[model samples]
Target: MYGLMSILVHSIMYTKFITPLGIDASLNRFFEARAIDHVQVLAHEIDGRQERRQGLKEAAEYIKAQLERLKERAGSNFRIEIEENAVGGSFNMMFLGHGISFGYRNHTNILVRIVNSYF
Candidate 1:
């Protein structure tokens, strides 16, 4: 798992344009410790399935916290913004033979957005 995470982080870093050269080093150090933590927190703690409204809210807060931490580390000029909006509810449905159907409604989603910033 560690190896996979390292590869994923490196791949992500490679895709972004590193500025000032020094930022690359800082980003490398930052992601080394935080990337896995972020993934675990989002994937495990933030359950987005049906009936998990609180979980969705918690996930949004978690993302905001992470962004704030990054902004603080990156310096005073860095800015982060978060927005929440209500989306139409969705239904999960499955149809079986003999005209049987099963479905459940899922609440709105919490959207997280990271503003323009240089890393």
Candidate 2:
């Protein structure tokens, strides 16, 4: 048989989403986590890898910590902007001739923008 590790991350994504590219490098630079230093600092690495309660919390904490670390390493070379919003709502719909109702409370959305001043 083969062996398995506790490493939670399986993938990484990088892109400049809606940013004006005017941030510092210290605020965006990370030591792996995604750059490959063996740290799992992404939401997708949630324990159990589920979008449910505890797992979600784990993922959120990981992301928060990573961002905090980046902030601590601040410099004028690059910049990073972070925003968090809590959204809750309910919806009712009919599916396959059945009535279904769903409501979510304290759903949080985190957005981060890494800007490179040079470009």
Cα RMSD to the true fold for all candidates: 10.5, 13.4
- Please provide, for model 1 over 1-119, each residue's C-alpha lDDT reduced to its tens digit, 9 standing for 90 to 100: 99999999999988866443332456526544456668888898778734546786677677767666665665454465545565554345546634544443443444545454656
What lDDT would candidate 2 get against the real structure?
0.61
The Cα local distance difference test for each model comes to 0.60, 0.61
For 36-87, candidate 2 gives per-residue lDDT tens digits of 4224434345556433467766666667777777766767867888787877
Shift of residue 36 alpha carbon in model 2, Å: 8.1
Off by over 4 Å in 2: 1-52, 91-99
